[model samples]
Every structure is written in structure tokens, then in C-alpha cells.
Target: MPLVRIHLDTDRTTARRVLQLHREGRIHHESREAARDQALRQGRTPAGDPVFVGITNGRRDVQLLYDVEVYTDATR
Candidate 1:
């Protein structure tokens, strides 16, 4: 499975909720679709293309940044 990292433009509440759903396996992989679907299901509007909820501190916190990696299993 590939790892997808998305920076969400959200606050602590959003982060907590998303993280919870993610941990509970509610979303499908950390891909864009998963995030978007999750947000939609929650009655929230997703940004676009791969939706990500990020956080901020001083000024802007949350954002949308992703990192994907492919993997394979082999048996000899």
C-alpha cells in the first residue's frame, strides 16, 4: 500500500475527527478520494481533486500535501 500525505486546511477539531476516522478504517487509504469521500459524508465540502485537511499555527496551518509509495509482496 502506498502512503499518501495530505495537508488539510482545517483546525484541531477537523484534524481530530479525520484522524479518528482514519484510525478506525472509515476512509479508504489516505488517497484523495478517501479524504474527499470522508469529508462529503460528514456534510462538509471538500476542496478539490485530492482533498486534504491541514492545520496551522502562526498564520496558515493546514494544507494539502501528499506522499505516495508503491509496494509489493513476493514469496519464494
Candidate 2:
């Protein structure tokens, strides 16, 4: 899959959640839909489209950023 990035304006809780997951080394969901759905509400794990959505159909390795911007874990 290709790597991409997105800037999201979010709160601390959500940012921390993503950061921790990134530290663990992967940001994944059952599917892109699940990720997109998660981000719909406040304080939820942010994901979807360019972030969690994979090009070839699979889980994406997402890395965390300060505050909250979403991008795939390029190092992986």
C-alpha cells in the first residue's frame, strides 16, 4: 500500500490514543469502515480513508503524531 498523511484538528485524548497505538507499532481496524466510523465521534480513535484505508485491501500500519494528524507508518 501507498503511504499518505492527513492533518486533523483533535483533542488530547484522541491524540494520546493514536500515539500509544503507534508506539505499539500498528494502527489497524477490521476494515476501513471501522476506522472511519471510529473517527465520527469525539474522543474516539481517528481513522479512515487515506489513513487507515489500504490500497490493496488489508490492515494499515498507522503512526501517531502530536495533537492529531493521521498518516500511515511509513517506516513499516
Q: Give the runs in model 2 whose Cα sits over 4 Å from its true position.
A: 1-4, 28-76
The clash count for each model shown is 13, 0
Listed in order, each prediction's TM-score against the native is 0.35, 0.33
- The number of the candidate with the highest lDDT is 1
* CA RMSD (A), model 2: 13.5
Q: Give the TM-score of candidate 1.
A: 0.35
Per-residue C-alpha lDDT of model 1 across residues 1-76, encoded as one tens digit per residue = 4333444455555556656665675642444565555445544443334523333343446443433222223111
Q: Candidate 2 lDDT, tens digit per residue, 1-76?
A: 3323333434455455655565676763333343444344433444325353222211343322222233344221
Cα lDDT for residue 29, candidate 1: 43
Off by over 4 Å in 1: 1-5, 28-65, 68-76
Clashing pairs in 2: none
For each candidate in turn, give its C-alpha RMSD to the true structure in angstroms.
11.0, 13.5
Model 2 residue 66 CA deviation in Å: 11
